[model samples]
Target: MLEHLGEKLILHVTLGNFSFSFDILTVIMSWVVIAVLVVVALILRRGLGQDIEEKPSRTQAILESLIDLLKGQLMSSFSSDKLARELFPFVSTVFMFVLVSNWLSVIPYCESPTKDLNVTLSLALLVFVMSQLLAVRMRGGIRYLKGFLEPYPFMLPLNIVSEIAKPISHSFRLFGNTFGGAILVTVVSAKFAPVLVPAALNAFYGLFVGAIQAFVFAILTVAYINVAVES
Candidate 1:
């Protein structure tokens, strides 16, 4: 049923003292996403303005708007434009990747990678590890570890739990939203006879919800990074 529903496409490989089972569809979709992003990046790169007085093209203007919006979000998180611009590439790419992947679910034979718990959880873990590493690198290991003991040592356990909860929340938020929407759309289209209603619902589910969730995820990630570094 899982395979039939396109939930997971499994394949296995083994090596010395280790083995792995992976989703082939997710692997393919991830590559597709990366390819799309690369192409967009190239187009944006070519569309960049070269002269101070040159009028910007529509693509350039749209790209500029995207950058500005992302920069604003990052500045809100970091309280510094310099820091936001410095971090924009990583943060903005995360937003774009998730945004594109989530929106792709509307196309036939394409599933949002977020529909798989493994993909979302892995991304969450990446964010978590990056946050902790940034905190440690900025504060030094001793100070970073000591941070949990601050405001009285009794808060240490709670702080530890809070840090661990971040990735869990991040993963589940994206997974639940995307997965539930996919399930609902599937059920509605399968059980009902209406075409227009289902199409509208799918558009809302794919475009609006997908975009909002992507934005939220990116914003939360920036918030986490800022908190980690400042702590």
Candidate 2:
């Protein structure tokens, strides 16, 4: 039953251990996303200036607005503390990457990298490890273990288990939503004839879902960092 369902939804492509399988449209969409981001980065780097007289074009204005928004969100969560300063770059990069990937899937032949279980899982694991390491560093070895004690000693086991589960839930939530959207769009496009209608629908889906997922992911990162860094 699982195999049948997967066969109906996914388009598998294998090349040795390096295999890529997803909705065909999503796979193509992912590439488009990567290309667009690269182009934007290059344009910004070229156009960015030392002199006050150098002015930004429309692309620079858009990029600056996005950066400002992300920075503001990060500041809200962590304030201007040392930890916030340290973590801001990593968190901002993750947000932009996920946002771009999610939005890319709205294009006819593209898919979000967040839709891939491997990608989401890897990101979650990175966050998990980083958080734990920060906690350990801040509190030292024995005190870090003592963090679970909180109000009562009996809750230690449960607290430890909950900490372990956080990454799993974080990764699955992102991957599931993105994959579901990709599958839905693919099915709709296939069932219809001319692709313009489906493309328009995809644009809306990408706009709404992409922004929400990016915000959620960034919020969770800030929360996790706060938990780890605060006593």
lDDT of each: 0.85, 0.76
**Residue 7, model 2: Cα distance from true site in angstroms:** 5.0
User: Which residue pairs show collisions in model 1?
Assistant: none
Model 2, 182: alpha-carbon shift in Å? 1.4
Per-residue lDDT of candidate 2, residues 1-231 (tens digit): 123333424688889888876656444555676688788788886666656677876667777887788778765687447877788788987787788988877654445767777778888889999989988987797998788897689998888888888889888888887777766666776776447766776776677887898778878878886777675
lDDT of 2 at 25: 47
lDDT of 1 by residue, 81-102 (tens): 6657777788888888899889
Top model number, TM-score: 1
Native-vs-model 1 lDDT? 0.85
Could you say which candidate leads in lDDT? 1
User: On a 0 to 100 scale, what is the lDDT of residue 126 in model 1?
Assistant: 89
What is the TM-score (0 to 1) of candidate 1?
A: 0.90
